[model samples]
Target: KLVDYWSDPDRMKQSYRNAVNKAKNKVTTHQGSKSFAQGRHEFVEMKAIQDESSAKTIPPMKDRGILDEVLKSINRYCTQEQFEDLKRQHALEIEEKRKAFESQQKVLKKFVNLFNRQQGTPSSQF
Candidate 1:
């Protein structure tokens, strides 16, 4: 599932832009707060406080039996050899996606650093 996400350059770029926008918006939202105006570290602390206050509590799983049944159904549908081949293919895809994502992140980091330098802004702001 994550491999599918990492495989799409357009989607990744969109997500990156959205994250930057969110960060800008966060700064804007906190502009009136004392901590935000105080310092960068204070702003980070304030954000962490807000995040902790807003964090959701996950509900515990109701049943483990369903998982066993799911595994059984999957095994029932595929031969051992077919399952092994699928697993190998999935692993290869995952590895390829991980490498691709790492390279993309490195390139993006360099580009962002260069852009930040040119704009006379800290990369941490975004």
Candidate 2:
């Protein structure tokens, strides 16, 4: 039904005008990221209206800095409770790594000692 409305030339032209006006406002910093995000959500909700293999389909744009941006954003926006939880989890992970390193070192030391004992000194030298 929505597509049928846009299929009309008059409605499509008006919609294009509204979109162009919004684009101009956005370029001039008169618009906010909120509306852009909402539009993205609407597009996704529309199921993109494309074929599985359509070359014309626009694949979702991915940010190369997404992980870094996410980490920064978390630092900026995380609540105290969330921050404490993350801090605790990070400490736990460090402790686990430390324990594993110590265990590996002990095993290596045991192996070296066993090897040296097996290569024992002669009775005359002892």
Candidate whose lDDT is highest: 1
- TM-score of every candidate relative to the true structure: 0.37, 0.36
Over 1-126, each residue of candidate 2 has an lDDT whose tens digit, in order, gives: 988887999998998999887878643433355576664564464443333224445653333232232324544576565679899999999999999999999999777777767898343443
Q: Number of backbone collisions per candidate, in order?
A: 0, 0
Clashing pairs in 1: none
Tell me model 1's lDDT, rounded to 2 decimals: 0.67
Worst 10 residues of 2 by lDDT: 62-71
Q: What digit string (tens of lDDT, one per residue) describes model 1 on residues 86-121?
A: 999999999999999999999999999999999999
CA lDDT of every candidate:
0.67, 0.63
Q: List candidate 1 segments past 4 Å from native.
A: 1-77
